[model samples]
Target: MSGPAPLPAPYALDDVDQALVHALQIAPRADWTRIGSVLGLDAVTVARRWNRLTEAGAAWISCHPAPVLAAAGQGLLAFVEVDCANGSLLDVARALAALPHVTAVEHVSGDGDLLVTVLAPDLVALTHWVTRGLGSMPGISATRTHLASTVYTEGSRWRLRALDRGQIARLADGEPARGEVPVFPLTDLDHDLIAVLSVDGRATYRALAESSGASPDTVRRRLGRLFAAGMLQTRCEVARPLSEWPVAVVYWGRVAAGALESVSRLVTGVREVRLCAGVTGRHNLLVVAWVKSLADAQRFEVRLNERAPGLEITDRAVVLWLMKVSGHLLDERGYRIGAVPFDVRAAARTAPTER
Candidate 1:
């Protein structure tokens, strides 16, 4: 008989690497020169280090539809709790991960064996996915879903605190627009550009143009328009086990309608809070965090109660295994092994939501 698959060795990040990743989190596509200035390293060194990390699949950059995309009346985002049959966890996870619309798949302990995020064009699509899509799939015995109503913060904005305030300021993303702004419709061209960036958000304009069948100038203008329109947001990502924050936790909580915004904002302010969104479930507020240890996870829970008394955390799930994040598939040690590119044009076949 064949032996069991070999376990992946964890890749540790030193201070410089952590700093570089943190800088990219601040400015996803910041030029090497600016990042170098912020990190006190030469531009070439910064670029070289990034290349090494990405080449090894230790880190990467990807783009996804911004909150404005949903606010503009696009797809619906829902959290799915999947109960897998015995011995079928791996099969079920791999099958779901291969789907286009299923964005994230995590095997956890608590209410369910897996937490799957799904993004569909409408209720019809979501229902079909839950019924036929998942019901018919082998190994999945049952599923529960929670609709996301307001996404106050996601993992894209989560960053490591390796840099000082001044250095962080030097690499921060552009100031977000104030108040409710007008929404813009996304074009086929915009979708094409997004598909390319979903694979490599830092892809050069020339490369994007070549792959997207547009002129370099056109690509640049369209990307700027997408950003200005709040239709697209990109972020740098790394293998969790490789970074300082390796443990992942999800908190299902509730917040009063009037206090939702305020409480969410307060909770998100916590450095460990990677995602805090309003949902239409028993527990309305869903928060996800990345911490350094299991103890830290417990500590975070205590800190959360102190920080946002209005928010009542119902259940918390520690990700025992994360099969996929955004579009990247991960190994046992959380290193990237592959990617299921983000493509909304494949709506008929699309998968889950952002982090």
Candidate 2:
């Protein structure tokens, strides 16, 4: 057999590239013409840049079932710390990265060799996955799982902050309002629609209709309702090497249950925090941030300590490599070579109360 695929060369983005990425993060599916107007570039030029980024695996757009959908008893989310036999870490990480439900897998420096974030249709499925599915895998010596009780912020919310107010306003002008609406249970069609989006967040109504077998009008109406109900979220992700902030760090902290909400809100407001959640474990709060370099980690910690005096950071780990993120598996070069679309509807069918 041939050796593994060659890693893509390291790419450093310039100011224009960074600005374009920031625009996509703010409005992931905006038309190229509109983005061009805001950035004062031709629509063709904007689209060409995006094409280059995606082709290089420097950036991509993906859709995820909103955390509110899980919190509403439709699915289960958990963070699992895994210990592997000395020589099996890479093997184990690659295996986990291939699973549809395991959104992120990072080789870290901490109590475990790998940290895995898992999503399932419900608690029963989650429990089964942890106890049976993961337990049966080779090389995994031990595992400690923490169920995410509340997701105050997800990576999707983090923006590069490279665009100015006028540019941001221009991009947001016709964006759909993403707010909480009455909970209308997702239908089979909705599940199919989400599956389509999981691969291409910017897929048009006509494209979605073709894939999901719904009329364009039905797709449009359903998508609007889902967005309004806070059951769907879109994110623009770029390769770390292509981003201004390349270093990623994870923080495990302890905060009293009573202070968890306030502390979460505080941390989420920090521009560095890409994910902030309350998990069930000794360290109740988990924070993930992307920064410019190693030194920025210390600075961020200091700021975090000052902002939330009561929060105690027990452990911090720098991510050496990200094998997978969301449903896309990455090569060492950070190019998306394969995908296992997230299927939350499968989990929703097995709804078991959180333990």
The TM-scores of all predictions, comma-separated, are 0.90, 0.92
User: Candidate 1 residues 55-82, lDDT tens each?
Assistant: 7778888888877767767777889999
Assess candidate 1 and give its lDDT.
0.81
Report every candidate's CA lDDT. Answer: 0.81, 0.83
Worst ten-residue run, lDDT, model 1?
1-10
Cα RMSD to the true fold for all candidates: 4.1, 3.7
CA lDDT of 280 in candidate 1? 89
Q: What clash count does candidate 2 reach?
A: 2
Output the TM-score of candidate 1. 0.90
Candidate 1, superposed: residue stretches over 4 Å from native: 1-11, 173-181, 345-355
